[model samples]
Target chain A: MTQHTTGAYDEELRDLVSRIAEMGGLAEGLVSEAVTGLARIDIARAQNVIFNDHRLDDMQRQVEERAISVIARRQPVARDLREIIAALRVSSDLERVGDLAKNIAKRVIAIDGQFHTKRLAFGVEHISEITLEQLKAVLDAYTSQDLDAAHAVRSRDDEIDAMYTSLFRELLTYMMEDPRNITFCTHLLFCAKNIERIGDHATNIAETIHFMITGEYLQEDRPKQDESSYIPAGYSSE
Target chain B: MTQHTTGAYDEELRDLVSRIAEMGGLAEGLVSEAVTGLARIDIARAQNVIFNDHRLDDMQRQVEERAISVIARRQPVARDLREIIAALRVSSDLERVGDLAKNIAKRVIAIDGQFHTKRLAFGVEHISEITLEQLKAVLDAYTSQDLDAAHAVRSRDDEIDAMYTSLFRELLTYMMEDPRNITFCTHLLFCAKNIERIGDHATNIAETIHFMITGEYLQEDRPKQDESSYIPAGYSSE
Candidate 1:
């Protein structure tokens, strides 16, 4: 009887992990489709990303429900409890990632035909590619409980931030060069910001993985290099 | 012995709720201070808001730890388990709201002495005021488990969204009118977006409350009126 109970609990835990992996896969797909739609100006693909966000949301609910049920039934302690909590945290992050992707996809529909700049599209595509890689790596680290892999994902977020900063400057210059470019470039700017935020969420998931494994908070401050700081020259409001 | 165990579990649950309330209060204060700092350009106040955000983060960790401990100890089922999960979810939302407020405060430091536009500052103040109201109402609803109040908060998010959309247009116009206004208005734009996002987080809390009370997902689609759809005149990329 005790063996049967242990086997059931193990099965439940495995099922929770598998559901999280499925949710991660869906989120990654949405990110890819959203950015691809932007680069290629594919409204149909963008719409698909937007419509499919509900699936991620549903999956997140399922993960939370299952995790909570397991906690109630098993009364898991210490590391076991932390693993259940981690699933909840990771699912929430994945859901937010999906929402961010949907935000980018919406921009594709919003900026349908104002102006198509291949250079700007290329910049966005490049940033999205890097962010997607980070997201994939973190999700893998999460499933495998690889602390080093998670740390690697956390360390690489600065690259996305730097790319976003340069893109911001480039988009600003484009707007200044042509007033007509303002509308289109502004949409692209938002899309880039959304992708950058996805990178941040991936880093968040990495931290959760570390906490899950160690049952302790990460003591180091997260390395952040978002260059949104706009210090005006010769300005002292103090 | 059973009665004594129940009493102890009740005490733990109560402690979790109290910590969440305390965290909510801090998050609310941070929002108020951050926006007030922006309106007055009070760098000191903004710095305080930024510094205090770490406290909210710490509180979130505490809430999670406490909730997990309770679950492990009591093995709460049904409503009891849901209540613990609600505390965790609410604390997470509150922490994100604190972070959003800090993001706004950081903008205060970023755009220190570039160009202070009284009208723009007033606009941000107005939007922040409404968002603060929504947040307070939602937080109260959460504590009381008042579904109607939660729904009211959700319904009011469109007001914030509409305000944000208009503010975005107004800020874009300001930037276009003068290159000098670019840096300042851009910062204000981001601050406004941050406040708008706080409103969304409040809506998220309301949804969590609904789930906690009903044990089911909110079946209705979230009311979203972020009027960012820009259909340029005479444009068709298809």
Candidate 2:
């Protein structure tokens, strides 16, 4: 009889965990669908993404409110409180991710079926894939409370930044090569940049998770500057 | 003798307010210089903006830290505490404003003596003017604590957004006209978007000031949708 009761309790815990996972999944879906909508130049799909964003917003608020109530009612402590707070922040980030996606979709619709340079489009696609991968990795890290995994994901964001830099240079070259390339390439640049920012936000989520697990802030390190040069004064970074 | 002491204290307060205003002026100078640097494609000017940003950052931190020390030592209450905290947030926002200026300068350097198409160039110049006006208006609002002035600044942000949207469309059109326009216009777009975002952060500062004085958030009211509107279930704004 005791074994039966313990099994039931485990199932309940699993169910709650699954619900959080489902919410994450939905948020991810929203971003992907929005990106796909842009790439395909599917206005209807883009509009759908915009229209459906309210649901994600509502979902995020709901998850946070429910978590808060559960904490208050049960007076959760230790690991339970940590988990609840992490879930709360994760949902919030997810909602922001949705907004970024919506912003891109809105831009795509504004373009009104115009295709920018194919190269620029391809660059955005690459960035989108990298961003989605980061999001997935962070979600996995949060679910498992794996700090090492989260740190790894955080470092990977630098790679995305590097890519963004290279893409920016390439797009600049394209516009210079043909003065006419300014119009379409600019939108492509924004789209790629939006993806890069989304990646940054995902990194932020991972950092928050790392903080929840360990009291230390992950952003404590100063931005890397060349050591061979004289360091600038008055900008004391910890 | 009592009146003399009160007068001296008032003079000290006036000095503090002047210092805050001076910092605000410095922030405006940085942003304007950054924009001018881009228009002229002046690498040296852009580098100067970047180099000087550290000073702004340091001053911001010092101001906030000193404000906290003053509150702790003086045991300020009510309006005094509110004013100090308001200064704290404003300083932080000013630092971010500096960072945004640095970001713009970085874009200018990234362009590396190259110029974008005239159309793209004009787009950035227009947006920069609009952003500068917003920055000026926000600073004035901060100094005066005029809620209506702040609100007017906030409303003007939509105009900035609209200009940004137009710029985005123009850039997209250029890129679509030729794949080669992708490179240079991409950089210009970054510069333009950075200015637009700075306007947004300035608006956020205005909102924070409004909140500090009135203790009410100024966000637009959430719209209620029908049950069939696909709103996330189980969540209420409450």
Best-fitting candidate, scored by TM-score: 1
List, for all models, the DockQ compared with the true complex: 0.43, 0.08
Interface RMSD of 1: 3.7
Ten-residue region with minimum lDDT total, candidate 1 chain A: A229-238
Question: After aligning candidate 1 to the native by TM-score, how far in Å is the CA of B193 from where it should be?
Answer: 1.6
Clashing pairs in 1: none
Residues A38-106, candidate 2, lDDT per residue (tens digit)?
677677987988888777777765674465445434444445445555666577678778877877777
Computed on C-alpha atoms, the DockQ of candidate 2 is: 0.08
Best by DockQ: 1
Off by over 4 Å in 2: A1-26, A55-95, A115-120, A169-184, A219-238, B1-27, B52-96, B115-123, B168-184, B219-238
Restricted to chain B, the TM-score per model reads 0.93, 0.83
Question: Ten residues in a row with the worst lDDT in model 1 chain B?
Answer: B229-238
Highest lDDT: which candidate?
Answer: 1
